[model samples]
Target: MKVKDGIIGLLIGDALGVPVEFERREYLKEHPVSDMMGYGTYNMPPGTWSDDTSMTIATMASIINKKSIDYNDIISEFCEWYENDAYCQYGLFDIGNTTQLALINYINGNPALECGPDDERSNGNGSLMRILPLAYIKDIDYETVENVSALTHGHKRSKISCVLYIEIAKSMIENDNLDIDGHIKIACDKIINYYKDDKELIHFKRIFENDLDDIDKISSKGYVISTFESVIYCLKNTDSYKDAVLSAVNLGRDTDTVAAICGGLAGIYYGFDSIPIDWIDTIPKIDKVLSLCEKYEAFCDEY
Candidate 1:
């Protein structure tokens, strides 16, 4: 029941903020988004979702159809699903250059491992944004999360960030006996153990542990590092769904993705009850998402 609620909460928060994403904080102050029924924006209407939910639904669809993570197959599914206008109401499908290049390369027959660029710069939050479904599916197993992340984003940074994020959600969902500090410690210890020798991972861990005071100083850009930081910030500071998402959305850059990622973690921590009922009720495609949840529940029965 918690898993079902968590997934729904994620989509609800993602869809709720679609219209206000990237709008200046001043504008939101003057015209607050107090509900999800609708918000008229320059280009889209209220209740529209962005790539966050689109890719999430694609991930869920792949799991339902294939019954397991297939790297190449999921990539193909994402491309076909996006191109076919499956989630067209989300506005322009302007995907990131790295993801677009990797997809194009895969279509031209490049090996999945070789599709992504060798440069570390390609490690963006794009990988993490589409990965919440995996958290609920694997029940937060570190090895399983790492394997799923490597399927599309094989870079070391991408893989580590993905693993850590899902582990956070997993710890929250599975550890009824533990408190928040215990969960954070367990997840951080696992991450440190996994990449103890890797400099980037070490730097990231150090930043997470010792740099609470400088969170605003840390970049909130679209990179994986920034997204990870933002998630930690939202988790540590906010007490409710509204505070968590509103704080993330106001963090200046990459607002939607940050809110989506933060909202997923916060949803797991606070449970579905923390989310506003009115927002959840009005989210677009609520019935379809509920159907997908039912399918996932059936699949879990077999496992």
Candidate 2:
């Protein structure tokens, strides 16, 4: 299944980035990551992933177990993973601030849809990092993407970025041969046209106009916009799936997230087989991932 490519590719990217998450690009210039070695940032053994994969798998489990994309079930799954450590090997190790607060809001009796902070400052990459499942979902729209994002981050910029990401992922699934630059242009134009009246929509216009080949000011941070731009930059600049994910990891801070997010796109465009088999074996709990992929494929078939 292409969803396997998207999810497992993302998990592999997350695992690859875990050991060197906070190291700067300049430092990585000296000691670059050649494989999925561990014991750097989080001090875990090799193959240990962070909240990026944890939440992603949680969401996937939610979709499969609930037999639908019910936001409440998804939120509950996130909570179960956060509090009960479901699907994660080492429990929750790296949750974003906004996600923590939003989970708290949910635990404190806030409506699942109303739990997230709507403040502009709350725009974060937490929700965006684990939103790949929606790409495989049937009959999804920008509003559904926003509501899902609203379970953690409620800002328009974040919601819009998620929509654009899902658009690219879905488009990639439909036409694997589509040119990446052209695909991005279509997604950007479609999103910009939909949200043109909003002044904030101008923030993503560069993605519409530029192909990221000449951009010298890329930031690899956890903020939603930076994460979105960084993922795009990595995808557009790299030639292969390996290079695309490596480019994201070497960009530094928030490495797992940046790579995981970019990996979904690279996986979709490059195909699942393009991901290195050695790297795939290096991930822990491969059986679980395989089972989830099977479940997702069967669910899609039935849907």
Candidate 3:
């Protein structure tokens, strides 16, 4: 149920923003994304999802098939998505530069864990966008989450972002009494305590210490920090699944990834019923994603 709640939410958010991924915030302010429209950015149909959903599905499928976190298998599935378009509905698009480089590193024989570039500049939302499924796995740990982020975004900042995001999602799944800010505070406390000595902690000071209420201060760019900040801002500001993802998309640049990440958390907290039925009906081949979610939930239960 958590798998379906999160993944389908991610896909809806991805599909909603596919047609306006890179439009500027100023532009979106004038021309907001109100509904699922088509063909503006990618020239695809109304419900076509971008690489965000595809890579997420690839991650879920890999886990379901292997029944364990096989790093090689996971990267192989990513390769399949990049080269063969196995998980995509309308061929691959919006592949991040960092992700492309890491997959190439894997193709050129680098180990899965080492393929990602570890430099500070390599930090992007590439890894965080697809990390939701891992939070559903019981007993999943920080190192494993870090390893998965290292598959495409090896920077310490990126890894910490993924871990923090998962901890928030896990909190949402396990506790219904907490509000969004409460769940985020719980995750931040854990991260701050564990990574107290790490330099990367400075990068998250705004999220860890501040309320992130200033809409003007938020950046919805592709940078990992920016994306995560944008997600937190949108989640804190909005009260429903629709408003959360819509706010993310309207923030403009990097619309799909931010919305996808926000939607994953919003879906879990708001519950699947909170998502609009018409939005779910719009995505093509949604049943496939739903079916995968069922299998993935089963696998996590057994694992």
Please, what is the TM-score per model?
A: 0.88, 0.97, 0.99
Candidate 2 lDDT over 1-303, as tens digits, reads: 467889988998899999998888889878777788888888988888888888888888888888887899989988998899887877777788899999999999899999888898988798899888888877677898999999988888888888999888888887756788878877887887788798778777667768456545877878888888889898888889999999899888889999999998898889889999988887779888878988987887677
- Which runs of model 2 end up more than 4 angstroms from their true locations? none
Best by lDDT: 3
Clashing residue pairs in candidate 3 (N, C-alpha, C atoms within 3 angstroms) = none
TM-score of model 3 (CA atoms): 0.99
Q: Model 3, which residues run further than 4 Å from truth? A: none
lDDT tens readout by residue for model 1, 1-303: 355555765676666666666676566557665566355343566656777777777777887788886766777776775567664454444466677777778788987656765468788777788788876764446666655555456677887888877777778887778765567778888888877787777648644574655664666578888777876776677778778777776664566778788888778777778887777766667778778878976775565
Instruction: Put down candidate 3 lDDT per residue, 1-303, tens digits, no spaces.
Output: 468888988999899888998999999999999898889888889888888899899999998898899999999999999999889887887799999999999999999999999998998899999999999999899999999999999999999999999999999999999999899999999999999899989999899986588889988999999999999998988889999999999999899999999999999999999999988888888999999999999898888
Clashes of 1: 1
Q: Return the number of clashes found in candidate 2.
A: 0
RMSD of each: 2.7, 1.3, 0.8
**Of candidates 3 and 2, the better by TM-score:** 3
**Candidate 1 ranges with C-alpha deviation above 4 Å:** 24-34, 37-42, 87-94, 139-144, 150-152
lDDT of each: 0.70, 0.85, 0.92
- Sorted on TM-score, best first, the list reads 3, 2, 1
